[model samples]
Target: MAAGIMLFEQKGFSETSIQDIVDMLGVTKGTFYYYFKSKEELLMDIHLRYIEALLENQKRIIEDSTKTIKEKVFEIVYMLIHNIEKQGRQARIFFREMKHLNEDHLKKIVEKRDLFRYNLQLLIEEGMRNGEFRDDLPPSIATLTVLGAANWSYQWFQPDGKLSDFEVAKHMVSILLEGIEKK
Candidate 1:
């Protein structure tokens, strides 16, 4: 699956073939076929795994009741950043290779992605209710801003770069909640 995902990202899904994956894996076609009926199945598996991991992490962040809504939001952003750092390749594949999934698979993945967004929206709503966030702003919009900033971090963020994931998360939280300029 790892090899398949790498190949899919390095090349496009349409461009990548089962033969390419098997050749990269240095295994027989039979070995690849034994695990996945087709390349599409393997890509779907990768997507499922990536989304499940993300949801699991987000759920945990929300479930930790000791933290205030603001803190939880910060943690959620941090968690997402950390995930990219920890699973950069898979994250790339998750976003880039999603288009290759058939309608049924795409629908399922979209559902999970929406679920993740919904959870973030709930967090934003909670913040509004608790007076930690501005109620004037739409919860959905704020949630999208936060999620978009974190989700899109994969484009330029390097796990081994100068700035740590935590640093990026902190900056993001500040940007989302407080904006720029000195108080």
Candidate 2:
């Protein structure tokens, strides 16, 4: 799968072939077939693994009673940014190659993605209810805005760049919460 992710990241899903993956790993096509019936199935596995791990981590963040809603928001953003550092190729492939997935696979992945967004939206709504975040903005929009900013980081963020993922996350969360207008 690592080979597939690397090749997919470099050559794209449609461009990548089962032969490419097997050749990269120095394995037979039979080995690949043993695990995945098709290349798309492998892609589906990647998508499931990525989103499921995120949901699991998010469950932990949401369940932690010690953190404030605002703190939870920061943690969630940080988590997304941090993932770029850990699984940068997977992140890139996830966003870039999703269009290749079949209808049923796409539907399953979209459901998981939407669940992640809905979970964050619920948290934002909780913050608004508790006076942590302003109630003026719609929670759905706020959730999408946060996700857009963090998810888009994969496009430009460098793991070895000047700014660490933590710092980027902090700045991003600050900007989202505080805005750029003068005080």
Candidate 3:
């Protein structure tokens, strides 16, 4: 799986061959075929693991009773940014290679992805109901905006840069909750 991820990240899912992955791991075709029936299956496994981890972390963050909705939102965004930095290749694979999955595989992944989105939206709805966030905007749109802002960062986020994921997440949350123009 590690070999497949590296090859997919380096050469993209469609371009990467099973032989390339097996060679990277110093294994033979029989060894690779023994575990996974097809290359797409390996990519699917990587995608499943990546998103499932995010969903699990998200559930934990959302379930913390002590944290307010605002805090929960911050943590959710922070978690995503942190995960992207920690698992850059996996994140890249999840975002970029999703369309390559077969219909059945894609459907399963989309379900999990929707569940993740729904959970975030639920948190935003809760905040609105509690008068924590502005009630003027639709919760769905707000949730999408928050997620889109954070998810889009993976394209350019640098883990080894001067700033940490924590710092970037905070800045992003601030811009999200507060406008860029002077208050």
- Give the Å shift of residue 46 in candidate 2: 0.6
Q: Which stretch of 10 consecutive residues in model 3 shows the poorest summed lDDT?
A: 174-183
Candidate 1 residues 1-183, lDDT tens each? 888877887887889999999999799999998999888899999999999988998899899989899898898899888998888888888888788899999999999999999998998898899888889987888888898999999899988888899998998899888998788
- The CA-based lDDT of model 3 is what? 0.93
Please, what's the RMSD in Å of model 3?
Answer: 0.8
lDDT of 3 by residue, 1-183 (tens): 999988899999989999898888888999998999999999899989999999999999999999999899999999999999999999999999999999999999999999999999999999989988999998889999999999998998999898999999999999988869996
Q: In order, how many clashes per candidate? A: 0, 0, 0
Question: Of the candidates numbered 1 and 3, which has the greater lDDT value?
Answer: 3
Which residue pairs show backbone clashes in model 3?
A: none
lDDT of every model, 2 decimals: 0.89, 0.95, 0.93
Q: Which candidate leads in lDDT?
A: 2
lDDT of 2 by residue, 26-123 (tens): 99999999999999999999999999999999999999999999899999999999998999999998998899899999999999999999999999
**TM-score winner, 1 or 2:** 2
lDDT of 2 at 85: 91
lDDT of 1: 0.89
- Cα misplacement distance, residue 161 of candidate 2 (Å): 1.1
What is the TM-score of each predicted model, taking all chains together?
0.95, 0.98, 0.97
Quote the positional error of residue 178 for candidate 2 in Å.
Answer: 1.5
**Model 1 stretches astray by more than 4 angstroms:** none
